[model samples]
Target: MTDPAKHAVLYRMVMPEHVCPWGLKARHLLRSKGFTVDDHWLETREANDAFKAEHGVKTTPQVFIDGVRVGGYEDLRRHLGLKAPDPQAKTYGPVLAVFAVTALMALAVSHAAFGSALTFRALEWFIGLSMMALAMLKLQNLETFSTMFLNYDLLAKRWIPYGKVYPFAELGAGALMVAGVLTWLSAPVALFIGGVGAISVFKAVYLDKRELKCACVGGSGNVPLGFLSLTENLMMIAMAVWMGVMALQHG
Candidate 1:
């Protein structure tokens, strides 16, 4: 095991189900700092409320750094004096080119799949909607993109740390491609990630696995998972890439 100071961090006073982003952020931040963090995200709602009431921190994300209390997002930002990712064109050059290529490739694939349909068929609609759902799930919070690892859902539901490599890289790369909100980064990351998700949906449908939760994000209601999910992921991947690229170029 690595030295604690070299690679050990701990998060205490956590609430499991009530929120996911705060602890998530702490973990990601530690990873950025080259530390391995142990997260404690379990607290009773009543207990959580009592603590919050006492501290005058009415929400989740009350953080403690090295056992010293750090404030919530605003406080953390103030403390760190963090600079947001440069939205300026100078910093995101490669990202712009990648997204442009991705957008074109996606269009080609989409046309091939649908044969220039002005009105999409039911299968097409389902696929489109599913993509939106998955994309939105992560997009709902910017914190998701900042994760330092991936979960190998087919193998283990636990997060596979980014350090393990490959599939994790794919997951992170794919997530950024699909889920990033920044214009330059979001599109390519979305394209790659959404494309992967599309493929997964199709493969699952091909294998006839229908009972599982689709795990698609927003606007997915009782939708049959399978072809619809695949189509949706693929389509959004393209759009996200375009938006990201556009955002970068004009900056």
Candidate 2:
């Protein structure tokens, strides 16, 4: 049986090029909460603008309950006793997700190669894969990454080209290390960047007490510049040293 009393009027953008995601979310939320939604689409920019002006609101995807304005998506959420996501909240979700995926990949590779998931090779692969994945993220938008990198990276601040070259170097080093070849080159590359990055992170976050976004996960600007960033660099440094020793022993 449908709840006749629970009715919501939703004004949302539905254009040729773009549809309002929030509006979709609002409708879904309304339906999930046992409300019948009367969806109204502002199909054109002019209509959207006119609706905004008529309603004296800045954004679309407005909702009304029982002929009274419930406001936009966030307001509807609040009206429905739900919490809305804060955009400015600092979260390690991206880094944690990256690490989790890389770790799984490492275990998978180790199992495929050594017939055992729990092996020393898994650790090596985890770090190498993490580096490569992070590098790929930065390479997706080099300019954006570099601009964010300059914020806390001491070397990047001084030498702008280093920021641009960093992703390529990381990718090369990670690929070589993962392949277990050219350790002579990969080890040094990893060590140099890791050393510089560790120092920069330590100075900026701890010494200067600066709260900044880490470029480790590229320029999306979610991960905080702190311990995790330092830990990432330290892992590279340790891996570099370990590989360097192994290379020397074999030679």
Candidate with the greatest lDDT versus the true structure: 2
**What lDDT tens digits, residue by residue, belong to model 1 across residues 1-251?**
33467443343345554555656675666567555555555467776677678778767656666666666644555646674343332322332333444455445555676775332232223333334333444344423322321221232224333213323333344444343344455456556556655655665566645444343432223334545445445666665655655566877
Candidate 2 structure quality by residue, lDDT tens digits, 2-67:
477899899999999999999999999999998988999999999999999999999999999999
**How many Å off is the CA of 19 in candidate 1?**
4.3
- The list of candidate 2 runs beyond 4 A from truth reads none
lDDT of 1 at 176: 46
Error of 1 at 121 (Å): 23
lDDT of 2: 0.93
